[model samples]
Target: MKKYKGYLIDLDGTMYKGTERIEEAGHFVDYLVRNEIPYLFVTNNSSQTPKQVAKKLNEFQIQASEDRVFTTSQATANYIAQKKDQATVYMIGEEGLREAIQTSGHHLVDENPDFVVVGIDRDISYEKYAKACIAVRNGAAFISTNADIAIPTERGLLPGNGALTSVIAVSTNTAPVFIGKPEKIIVEQALEVLGVAKEDTLMVGDNYDTDIMAGMNCGIDTLLVHTGVTTKELLKQYNSQPTYTIDSLSDYLKHIN
Candidate 1:
């Protein structure tokens, strides 16, 4: 087993399922803390801010801090800022996505804008979708926080940001530039934040498609734990495999120092 200098972890299924926490996840984080290994929780959830996400983790008895969390909303804002400075944006999402765009010095407008940013908006309305479609049709660059179609919840799998993002994309016949997992954009940004080389960093999560593929897309090692969406049987269908697979996060503690 190779020692990793830094880690990019997933939040939902990897750490907890909806409102429930995975017990082994706390131990895994403890190992990282005790060894002084650098780590960041990378998530596709765009509804909550970093502080809120950390609070949720703390509730699970998992050690986490706001500074140690990176969200797709942050990635989307950073990506847009890099492309154009202080660009005008028309966004449809919750507080986290709104905060990221505002904090990045981007102007949020009602009508025509430079960009049409979409994330998970639980309060999604027909008017919100209409405005987003109008913005994109008017030539604004379309961007989505993530392409995840469904999210696991206590209720069951529900619509995610990707599902919400599709309204504008299908309406305007424009493909959105997705910024989260399975795309190299978020992982690349995360690596820069972690200040670690790709070869020395590990991406850990339970989902094979988003988490493992994100690492593979960015040339980083990946570990797949079977506590979430993808099962051992489901993973066997994929031709490409993660660098390591474990029954739980506790199984991975032995690989690290």
Candidate 2:
């Protein structure tokens, strides 16, 4: 196996499932820290900030610092900033997404927005949908954090950002640029944050569709651990598999030298 200089890891499935913690996941992060290997918990979750994510990891007994966490929200803001400076945006999401946009020097407006961005908003309403649709129809740039149709939860499957992002897409018949997993945009931004070369970094996660595909799309190696989402059986259906696969993060511990 190739030695990866840095790692970009997934959060929800790979680290823990909702409020429950993953045992091997904690030790895996411990190994990274001990070896002085750089890694970032790259997440599609746009509801929480870096500090919030790190706190959650700490609760799980995983060692994490704020700088070691990166979210799709930050990627979205960075993307918007790169495209245009101080652009006016109409955003639909939680505190994390709002903070990212505003702190990036973008103006949050209700009318004639230069961009219309959507992330996961559990408290979604019809009015928010209408505004998003109106903004997109007004020739505003549309962006979605992730294309995940569903998110796995302790209760069962729940609607993800993509499902919520559909309203604007269907109404305006305009597709939003997705910045999360399975898209190269988020991975590129994560790599930039990690300060590592694509070839020398490994994308680590449990989901085959989003996490694995994101690495493949970004020309980076990926290691899929069966601690969450994709089971070994389901992974075989994919034509292109991840660079590496293991039953758990514990199985990968020996290879990290």
Candidate 3:
């Protein structure tokens, strides 16, 4: 097996399933830590900050730190910053998204903004949607954190940020530039943060559509573990495949050893 110098790992389904811990995942992370393998937990979740994410991973007994977590919120903020310095943004999301934008030296406003960025906002209301629509129609560039239509939870699949973003897109008849997985934007930013070349980095996740595609889009190898969204049978139906496939992280651990 070819060894990878660095890894970009997915969070939700790849690390833990909602509130439950994935035991094998902890072991895999432990192996990475023991070997001092460079890795970053790349997540599409825009609601929680890196500190909160690290806290959640520690609860699962997985070794993680704020510096090792990369979120879509951060990617969105970085994207906006690169496009225009200190651009004014009209955002619809939670604390993480808000903090990312403000910390990146961008201004957040309610009216006549330079950009309208959308993420998962559980507290979404008609007024928020109305304002977003107005801003987009009035010439603000539309951007969404991810295109994930549904999120898995203990209650089952619920509407994700993509679904929420659709409200503004449909209302204003405008298409949004999605920054999260299945798109190259987030992965490209993550590579820069990880400081690893694409040829030497591996993207690992349980979702084929988002995680695997993100790697492929950015010319990185991918590893798909059948512990979450995609099943063995389901993955077989896809024309493209991950560079590596394992039943669990434990299986991959054996190969590294």
Query: Which candidate leads in lDDT?
Result: 3
Residues 153-210 of candidate 3 have per-residue lDDT tens digits of: 7788899999999889888999999999989999999999999898999999999999
TM agreement with the true structure for every prediction: 0.97, 0.97, 0.97
- Report each candidate's C-alpha RMSD, comma-separated, in the order given: 1.1, 1.2, 1.1
For model 3, where is the 10-residue window of minimal lDDT? Answer: 11-20
- Candidate 2: tens digits of C-alpha lDDT, residues 147-178: 88987777788999999999889888998899
Q: Candidate 2: misplaced stretches above 4 Å? A: none
CA lDDT of each prediction against the hidden true structure: 0.93, 0.92, 0.94
- Best-to-worst lDDT order: 3, 1, 2
lDDT comparing candidate 3 with the true structure: 0.94
Q: Give the CA lDDT, 0 to 100, for residue 109 in model 3.
A: 100
Runs in model 3 lying further than 4 Å from the true structure: none
**For each candidate, how many residue pairs have backbone atoms clashing (under 3 Å)?**
0, 0, 0
Q: After superposition, how far is residue 160 of candidate 3 from its true place, in Å?
A: 1.1
TM-score, model 2 to reference: 0.97
> Which ranges of candidate 1 are over 4 A from the true structure?
none
